[model samples]
Target: MRQSKRIAIIAHNNKKRDILEWAEFNRLFLAQHELYATGTTGKLLEQELGRPIHKLQSGPLGGDQQIGAKISTQEIDVLIFFWDPLEQQPHDPDVKALLRIAVVWNIPIACNRSSADFLISSNLMHNEYQPHLPDYHDYLERNFQEHAIQVNRELPFPVGTV
Candidate 1:
């Protein structure tokens, strides 16, 4: 099994209550590790869990983007976001980006209550999950060169750098 991990929780306005209720039910299991969430969702979960959470901006205001960056950088290991399917949100694109990133990174994601339940109940999920993140200097440089040449205009990569 893995070690400890950073987890991000997010919810749509309409689904905030559901997330809160779910968190409340599993507070003990959740309290053991790092927690992050969007503004309102974090606030509500903190209030319900009586624990501190690293809160990002509101979803529409870039909270989702903040979480996305964290996940992309492998700063987040688990993503349990309760999205509202019936309602069209202004931040749908952000949600899609986050979901896509999660998939690309092979991080575990729970989009609904049932999957969330399965995750929280799993021994591996609750025990610990540590990601082995190595130096990204070369990786970042290569990616930047391939995808964002402008972003690396100021930096230089050494020969055979890893």
Candidate 2:
């Protein structure tokens, strides 16, 4: 990741105020990095920070998936998602997938204000850091080979003759 990290911020309905407060407190540091957020959150942040934010759809409207895609493509370096754990979200699967993808891509994630503070304040945040990416090539190859074997066994014709 670059010194100027690409940070994605998200907040549940119940956590919006908290996120806004946390964001306002770190406005100066946040201004130095690239900012992204869901629809409503992005608008609020832009107004609060007086800067541009890359806004996507609302969280329930596919914003989480969009952020997941960015994480997979290495477009986003950090995720500050203040999700409401007690409240059940209608789009829970998407939220889960977003978290899964972040882990898969080995990006830093902050689920609450305390964690966000720790993450943002870390020395690594200001330096060019390379995160460890999980190796999936072997897993992919193994699955493909297994599928081929299964297909061969299911075939009606003899292996050499077919």
Candidate 3:
């Protein structure tokens, strides 16, 4: 089985409602994929959309760290962070790290609703997504074809040569 790209939804206190609305709008696409979120945002989205979600702590309560770990592990493919640019986050380092990792890893990230909408509305989300559980066999399988071609090119005698 292959793993679907993991997506984490998070929001600042003021943007929670917006995140919920976005989640509700894209529930079908989201439901088929794994959802991780900060505490209040997760609860709210779950209640409004009638969907169960894996909840992490509140962002101020180490939730951002959780996201950072997932991003570093390449477990999180998209980060929908609805942040309030005006608010001063006490855990600023966590926020910085989360965004930094998202950039460093080249994974898609959305800091506002506009970007979030663009991401969820992408063809990748609209099409059917095969759920990959626990193992990333599918991701590996998808990459294998390219790797095989590269391997063949690098071999002086061509691949599978005696």
Candidate 4:
């Protein structure tokens, strides 16, 4: 059997219904894991599933950042976010950053019902799936080396010289 994972669920205003339906469809599978969500989404899901959820603030009020922080700290194993592409959010940057963190952490993220279905049904969800995470320390060291080389080449130049 797959290990119980910490799953975060988030949905935009327009995509809430879709997420609710998808969650309902996967209730059994979801019940086997730890659940978390943003404000309205969390309340709605808790009511629908009759299960407790670790609720955070509304997205615009910092929920996305909260989740991102958790992802950075390896607190979340999966992300199921149904964001509305047809709509614009005031916290768009926060949303993007949250997604970026998930990617950087090599977490499994599902952006839609289809992908959610696939991910939930995949054998990896129930089993240990080791992700190939980037060696950021090495990358930072390489970047520092490159920056030093560039700085060395630009040193001792005349102030007004091209």
- Tell me, by lDDT, which candidate is best: 2
lDDT winner, 1 or 4: 4
What TM-score, over all chains together, does every model reach?
0.78, 0.94, 0.73, 0.86
User: Please, what are the lDDT tens digits per residue for candidate 4 over residues 1-162?
Assistant: 238889999999999999999989889998999999999999999999999999999999999999999988888899999999999899999999999999998999999999999998988899877767667999889999998888877889743576
List residue ranges in candidate 4 displaced over 4 A.
143-162
Residue-level lDDT tens digits of model 2 in 87-121: 99999999999999999999999999999999999
lDDT of 3 by residue, 1-162 (tens): 123557889998989888888888877778778888888988998897787888999998999989888876767878999998998989888899889877766677889989988987777655544433345568789799889999888888886667
Query: What local lDDT score does residue 161 receive in model 1, on the 0 to 100 scale?
Result: 64
- Say which prediction, candidate 2 or candidate 3, comes out ahead on TM-score: 2
Find the number of clashing residue pairs for candidate 3: 2
Model 2, stretches more than 4 Å misplaced? 155-162
The lDDT of each candidate is: 0.85, 0.96, 0.81, 0.92
lDDT of 4: 0.92
Candidate 1 vs. true structure, TM-score: 0.78
Error of 1 at 120 (Å): 1.3
By lDDT, is 1 or 2 better? 2
Ranking of candidates on TM-score, top first: 2, 4, 1, 3
Candidate 3: list runs displaced more than 4 Å: 1-3, 126-162
